[model samples]
Target: MEKKIVISDEQLQFLSKYLNKKFPNLSPQVKIELMDHLICGFEVKGGDDFYQYLSNEENFIKGFINNEVKNVKKTYGKQTWRQFFSFFTSRELLPITILTLFIIFLISKSISNKNAWLIFVVSTHLIMIVSAIFGMINKKPLRKLDEVKYLGAEIWLPFLMVTLADNLGFKNWLIQNEFIFTGYWFFTFIYGVSAYIVLRRQKKIILTKYKALLN
Candidate 1:
């Protein structure tokens, strides 16, 4: 019986850093999986000459990433977009979207005065900023669901962009303007709903695809 070779921690760190440079876009989850395969599979294959063999054949790493990693990237890309579009089209999201619309309509009716709506907008945004900062400060260990960070960004980017445009005077887009105000609230509420979807969907994905790895 032969003893299996195990990769050293220093070597693992070096591999992690080198591969990170090669595939900087890979999620932390993907990077960890690569390291797992290299340590468990590649290192074992070369046995006594493993280090020397790996040093001479860096292309092996590149080939693995270009093939395996790219495929993973594509699958992730499609899943990401589908989750986003789900906000607009999925039957599950339909009720949430309707609820958000009702909230916006109520906001509009509650503050018929333009100046009142301005105050509401400013106050609401201030609360949102504080909430985001607090959430970031207390965030827990990253799960695959936490990979929903990108999807979360997509949810919020619309509001950020609209606000940026208004502030930059791209239009006389005052929050006091009923159209602009409602549009902002619409995005915000949709974002809230999409966030719920992200949490649920990412949990499913991790359990379905990475259950063994997670366990």
Candidate 2:
């Protein structure tokens, strides 16, 4: 019969410190997963040469972290676009979408000056930039997975919104053109709404994942 190896609290702390020292910027979520992997790998080696094993795997772990972070960002990138388009396909969101477009139409008709409309669109983009800054600063102690997923999605989103807005605002001629300016307002409004929906969904998922962590 084989004896089961259990890691001691001291050993776990040492492992954690080692991880922190090696990867200072590791996301809490990935850190936790890596911890589990280390423990399992150590146990598989008859609980011997833990330090040697860790040292050997340092580069491999770094590569793993890089890949994981990239994959997470890529996934959220796809999800944001998917969520944006979902508004049109979703039966529940259909009414809200129609109402939103009607309101935009009303606003467009009401604003006679092209300059005013350009200002309005640029202001909306500025608001998104502010929101992105908030997301980065608002740190909460969440579960490992929640911290990873929430930060991953939230951090990536603000950059996208800010970049999109900045690029559009840069094209002074686009906003000045009669036909493009009209479509630009609708695009900005819908894009902002989609971003809001995705952020809200992320909050909901994080809250649901670890209700006790926040309390």
> Mind giving the per-residue lDDT tens digits that candidate 1 earns over 1-215?
87767777777777788766766655566668767777777656746655575565577666765675456445545655566567779798778777866777677657655654554456446534643543222223333233434433433544564467567974344454656666666765555444444445655664556455445
lDDT of 2 by residue, 15-47 (tens): 999987876766666889889987887787765
Model 2 lDDT vs. the true structure? 0.64
Pairs with steric clashes in candidate 2: none
Q: In order, how many clashes per candidate? A: 0, 0
- Candidate 1: Cα lDDT at 71: 62
If scored against the real structure, what TM-score would every candidate get? 0.48, 0.66
Best by TM-score: 2
Instruction: Please list the C-alpha lDDT of all candidates, in the order they appear.
Output: 0.57, 0.64
